[model samples]
Target: MAFLKTIREVGKYFHDIYSGVASLMRGMKVTGSYFTRPGSIVTQRYPENRDTLKMFDNFKGELMLIHDENNLHSCNVCNTCARKCPNGSIEIIYKKVEGADGRSKKILDKYVYHLDTCSFCGLCVPACDELALKFDQKFEHAVFDKRKLTKVLNKPGSSSKTTNE
Candidate 1:
């Protein structure tokens, strides 16, 4: 009686296996048709056709400091982005200067950004209400040396000094 029950269980297992195989074959038939169709293939040559491609507005690439023609960036050196960066890749040096009202104003000294360690998260952008930071669509950041990856986005001699005090 035990042997008969074991044999009955084995027969039931094969019945289920055949059902699964049939289901798989049905799915494969649809895929096989698509494989033969030229329009169904969805692969793009990225490097060769880069000029024709368009990046999404929200796509996070590289962070850049937007500097005006005067070489002054909108960043007040609040260090909001440096503190919020998860990788500690951003370093903002604050320069103390006398404001027109005779009060000391915290100005951006140097903005050191390490592209190698940046996660490309846009958290740093909105944290700056001054709109000093923005993501540039240019993503070709490869460099031969690691030191080259560390960049100061702000132009030299852009900081204006207030002598009102």
Candidate 2:
């Protein structure tokens, strides 16, 4: 019985070793394929191709609020995006005001976005049921000062449905 237990343990150790070796070979095969392909270079030339360098559609860049031609937005200040963000990157400051219908309504005071804290999770864009938020393809986020990262999305004289009313 002892001999059989020892044999089983040895077999399990060998199995683990084989599995590790198989994974290593698989990874090495991929690396070898890439190494052999000189024309398959994927590195971007950056500033040289700045004018032609287009980011992929799925690339997450700067978070922005979509506004109409008249500087009107659809954000109701519902806080859905702020709540869904894994990091506290979005701060929606809203104020209650009397609407045109005489009912109290909320409007965006400041749509503060802290890009420094953002994880680029893209959760906030979809969480916004109003479809007021989106990510742009402007990848140039390098700034000398960290304070520049914090952005207020609302443009000057911009107003939402409640505020416009």
What tens-digit string does per-residue lDDT give for candidate 1 at 1-165? Answer: 999999999999998999999999999998888889979776665565568767887767788888777666677677899998999989987778777778888777679999999988778999887788889777688889999989887778776322211
The candidate scoring highest on TM-score is 2
For each of the candidates, give the backbone clash count: 0, 0
Error of 2 at 47 (Å): 4.4
Q: What is the lDDT of candidate 2?
A: 0.88
Candidate 2 lDDT over 18-68, as tens digits, reads 999999999999888878997887565556576888778877889989989
Model 2 TM-score, all chains together: 0.70
Clashing pairs in 2: none
Error of 2 at 10 (Å): 41
Off by over 4 Å in 2: 1-44, 162-165
